[model samples]
Target: MEQSESIRELTQSIEKGTISLPEFQRDFVWDITKTYDLFDSIIRGIFIGAIIYGKPSFEIAVREVDDRPRKGQGKNRKLKIDKFTREEIANKVKVNNYRIVLDGQQRATSLFRAFKGIDEVWFIAKNESDYDYNEILDKNLSEQTLEEIIYEISGNEDKERISIKLSDVYDIMQQNWRESKIEKEIFKKQTYNGDDDEGYDYNLEKYLTICDKLQDIFKESKLLNYYLLDMDVDKFALFFERSNSKGVSLKFTDILAAKLYAGNFNLRDKVDEFKDNNTAFANNFNQEIIVRTLAYIIGDGREKIDKSYILKKLNHEHFTEYWDKICTWYKETLNFLFDNSYIVSQSWMPYENMIIPLIIFRWELGRDFSQMNEKHSEFIQYWYWSSIFSQRYTGSSNEMIIKDANYLRKVAKGERILEKAYFNRLARLQINTKDDFYDYNRKASALYKGILNLVNFQSKGLVSWENNNKLNFNDNRLEDHHIFPKNYIKKRFKDDLEAQDKMSSAINRTLIPKISNILISDKAPSKYLKEIELKNSSLRESLNKHLIPLEIMEMDELFFEILDERATKLFDIIQNILVDKQAYILQNHYKEREHQKGYIEIFATYQNQEIQAHLDLETEKVIYKNEHYSPSGAASKVKEEVSGKATSTSGWHFWKYKDEEDEVKLIKELKE
Candidate 1:
């Protein structure tokens, strides 16, 4: 049956315990801005949307009060619904008679809260024509004030305030006009000029008249129109789905949540509690992920496990049974990821959905953590790296997940090894190169995370450089440090953006303690490396732990050659770890050359200190105090020393030396 009711009657029904919200409905999430817009639309004679109601079992017809107030109510205060108790309502109503709001919850709650003066709802004053609802202006009133004037105009008692009709805002406006007339009369007697005074009075009268008209427009009750569905629970679900399909306001998980709620199982709340309890891994955990995991465990296929099927198939008993097992396997899987895989937390995890299949595989292994052997560990590691390198889950189809899930199930049962085909699929994965490994957007990519995992595996765990103490996942002491300091690169490149970017890529980044990063502060790798070696006895071992090539410690300058060598070494290390290859020799990429070959020493005095540099006449390579530079680049360093700031200098004009004739001449003059 369908019927129409005024906003007043609807609010009254809510107060009298005839209407309520169901437990399955989402929480009141509307902000004050939306509330303001809702009332603004109503006041402008605009048609606000309709509400949908469902008749549920009387036992489960419990309603939660709409405690979310608009602005000007005390922070975190909810409007109390005093007249009805759940017990009283249950006793009074039968199963088919219980009405629960299926839609328009925000509207009904706003109306009920406004009418009862439980919260202040604001509106633009008619006197101000250009008011925007978003701005914080003075032209607003509390719903309580609006209600008081309405009652005074209608000559209603204080007890009538609770049940005051929405239509009464019109009568309240009429009373406001009557009060304005009395003020106009008093002002007319005090200053009476025929034209100016009467014109002023007329405009004042017009403004007051507009205020009344605005109130009249707001109180119109046709805005509360709705369709009443007197159907059973199953029929209501179908109707809800069909109505919401095009709007996308509700998701499949929401319908599943509703179904679980009807069965006295609050899935959403349980998931929330799970997240709260496991706060360490809760950053990326959400209801959709939980439902997706549930679907994998019991769903026939990805497509079938959608909204419609879940609404029909999911029940409290099945959900509870599977949820418990999933929870157990989920915790175990996270432990595997952290302890073995080096994924420290959810933030470092690239694809959260990847855990779903792992959970399924773990379940098939009899949920026994002790059964995991070296072969099994290798299989898991191989699968993890291969999936990451292959980008297996990025835009994966439902059928793909089904196939992978089946494959993993076989692997878990020792039926197969991760084959050559899987490895070949990732053979072209570009992670071996410096450019590929040193990504700027590494945090969001799986390869970056995989590299971190490999580093963690090599190091046993991350450690603080300051004290050589083991740092855990929860510690905030670690940060990404540029191996070749950014400032040094900037000095080296200056205006060359491409070079700066290359130097600052992910290959240069390593996790070091915050204290160590700060202490390193733009110092050259040559300086910091020696200091660390002096402080720590196990210098070579510690350097290797960070996946740093031992050659970097001895290098005079961090060149592209160093970065490329280290990146290739790290990639090989990851490859060996993934394939369980032992006794694989690491290839040395370092090349030997004659020291200071084909170069002549040039001396300069800057800031009263003698600086020496060597210039390679054949290659045009200038070495300033063992650091490589161009001739002009060497002059820039000298200029920095002289001015205590970076400035461009002409090396030809800056450098002078005694030529073959035993006369001092500038390099520029000699070249000319």
Candidate 2:
């Protein structure tokens, strides 16, 4: 059945406990800005879509609507949800016919909050002719014409802009306009002209017309319509799936949770238990990782673990069977990662999906951590670094996941090592240019996290200036302290977002103690570093531990200079990690001849056709036909060009470098 209610009636229903949300419904995620837009659209007579309400045959948990704004962003952010007690719904509240908001939860909640004047303060523009909502409504809320009035402006004395609070608009819409206090106020504000009441009366009429229109906008009950669904649990579930197929669809995990609940298994409870123990990891990688990894493990490392795989093939029974063992494997994997990769916290992980393979490696090796030998450790480290530098898991990684998982199982038995060709490709793709490090986004980029991991590994973890103690992830006090603070850079760059972004680059970031960060807050590095160094005796060691150059920090107001210097230094570190031995060996061979800047020329002969190539000593890439490639990649290309088909060839043995005395030697022989 279909039903219609005024915005006021819907809000009243919410208050009276006749309107509620299912326990499975996600909490209100609308920010204050969204609330502004919702009311703005309603005021303009725009259709904001209809709500979908359902009455289920079976009893289910229900909750009150979350009318609060979004608290934070990223890891620290959440919209709090509170479930209503059964007793309150059944007896005390007297809600025998309450309906669940199957759809439009955000809209319904936003309307309710706006009507009640909760948390956010909103205002309507008095001069409707000054700005057209129709024109700017299609754009972002920040770019809209009504941005000023829609914001919190309760104390604002801008008489030309805001006419009234939106809450007051709702009140006036429900009140008798002629007898309302607002109507009397409008009449009182009327001005006199030459002792004649004509001008005052004209002004009074204009103000009343505006108020009437605002009243009529909310007073119209047909504007807020809803579809009422009355069905059994099974039919209701089907309707829920179909109705939610588009437009902010439920997360696969949520759907899976619902399915498991019906089957007498609680996926969410198990996930909550796991997350309770591993807060850091769970904070970064949520329940999706848990479900996906379980599916992969259950399939013996062959499952795609995509939405289809999870919904159809993921057996809750298998999940329960392997849950405890998988948890143990994850812990062991973390232990190994901490020792080798220096990823002590979830923040440093290059990719969350990397956990799947690492766990699988540990699980496939043995039940005991003692069984992981030197070879296993070496292989795991190689795979870990190779995958990160190659950016293997950046995009669609299902195929790569299966491939790597199978290889890891074999590697566990010492069947083979990750090929040199693999590392060669990783070296080619590794962060090479100074711009690469500078462009690495703040905490969001995998390469940025990879660099952090590398720094942590090399420095054996950074020490804090506060007490010169190594900053630990377990402390919960480690902050992403900006070397050049955000406020300092914002003031320096002043409205240049690009310059601000560059200044706030990951190169300008390092982990420090919360106290140290607070003490150093917003002060220029030149000013703060001096004070910090004066207070700490091991300042040099602390700076070195964070890979911060002492001389660079001493330079006042050279943010870009610091950025460039740190970028070069970080690139050097990354290059060392992904250093191709053949490239380095050839460069070193050329260095011996004092040809530091010039390219290393190597030659190959195939069927009397001589091929010449130049190796860039810095980048370690071969230049043939003006295109750069890794030695092996170039070798394959050259062979394919001449022979019309190419197989993998050892570039070391194929190309020969000529000595100054006319002696030619294969690079492989030179290695000896």
Candidate 3:
């Protein structure tokens, strides 16, 4: 029962250092991203404080007991007990040790920030709550208040948040009462159930009081120097780990790397400076890989390394030698192939199309390549997402791609003949006309043919190609717009067999414009074709010219039919690109026993090293191209899919209606 006035008086003295915040108190308890957490507790009237002396330097906490006889009023910092139930206080009624909050880690940290200098400490109004999607999509949010947004989504709109006065927080903790105040015993809380060391589990209410006290001290005292000596490495690790509630946890290994060179010196900070680099942790590679590399680079066995290890390791002497190599690998190994588009947004590898495995090259092949090698950019991008083909790929197709990655690596390392084994079809390309897929694949028999074609074509450049006497697109920027919307198709159709069959077919999807996707305005092309033909004369005429096969103009079905023809032409354009892609990989076939895994098929080339040892290793990749038919014969379908979802009757099990004895009739009843 600390009185507001008494607590203010004591807090004023505490700010003067005449009194001190006790130790072993709980932390400020609130839920804000960070700054908001500090703000909300004060506004809602919760108690927060800090402690100095258990482990490390200190611990942030809410005070459980103090110097008071019964509990009428308190005098230290401003205090409030509106939410503290008798049960909660009773629980912490026993333990006693030193009793003064020395550091309000979270609060002090928060208030020192410019944003927290608020009307008092920060405080979100008690009215805030959940979000309603239906409301957000249709309602005018511009005119709504935070409370209103919450109300729209939350049935319990009237629920209030914790609140308290700023002055009373730090003030009420420093009182000189005649009798000792017994606080309820607080237990070590659990944040995550995975492991004891996993997450932060602290009381929120106690933290704000500490923030208030620290804020006052910062204002009253002109102490430019911060002495977080008690806030040593362990506490630093603990405090930082506990803080992140909404986002992801900062890996201990990363922290270990960070700790290697503690101080103002930044380890990961340099990553921010690079162009097109997402973070210090990843280049074109995703964040997880970078972290894994960091773990391995430190030689900390991957699992043992963390921020602490990093902090301990970083220094002027060793930081450069060890970290420089990683940075080099990051910029080169990672950058060479990380096509942002190919990276399917996964934790491992930038694009799970499998370019991530290339990092292993830095160790196996060494760093002879630079990120700026324009000649190799296409090679790298293809390799990064090469797995897209690999996952669905098999046979010579896969072997071809492996040879491709090997070829690139060898070529970079000054190896010749690496391109010889890479067979690419180049016969289709005519100096005067557009070459189709089969014509191109014909040139793909040898790596040299395709390489020559690629070198010739690329060296000619698009400007040169357009200038030549061949049909060319005037537009430099070609966008891959989906013909069938992935999201829209998913939403409108059930995941049943028919819907899935339609959705999965490549013929159903195609690319469109960045500004204007033709798929827009709802009613699909079939429904809207007639309107389009009447609206755009140029489109109608273009459709007539590129009729693909025979009677396109004859059908007169209109826009969709015309659009379908153009889309087929577009697919041809895409097919040509794939042909070049195939040639690129074909010419660069290094095909070491190591990359044999990528090849769907390989020859059994014996080891040149040992005669008795029949073979050095398996000289071929075990993969193959699998041909499949969609439910409707458009896309490939697995045997199971063809038999199960597509078949009219159960293909897996047969029913014998003509059993003379009906032998299984009794068994059927038992089975059921």
Candidate with top TM-score is 1
TM-score-best of 1 and 3:
1
What is the clash count of model 3? 112
On residues 364-480, what C-alpha lDDT tens digit does candidate 2 reach at each position?
787665677776655565567667866888888766676577667767766652234433444556565878766776677787787667677778776777668766655566656
If both were scored by lDDT, which would come out higher, candidate 1 or candidate 3? 1
- All candidates: CA RMSD (Å): 24.5, 17.4, 21.8
Cα lDDT, all candidates: 0.59, 0.65, 0.33
Candidate 3 lDDT trough over 10 residues, lowest sum: 608-617
lDDT order of candidates, top first: 2, 1, 3
* Residue 176 lDDT in candidate 2: 52
Worst 10 residues of 1 by lDDT: 582-591
**Which of the two, 2 or 3, has more TM-score?**
2
Cα miss at 650, model 2 (Å)? Answer: 27
Query: Which predicted model would earn the best lDDT?
Result: 2
Ranking by TM-score: 1, 2, 3
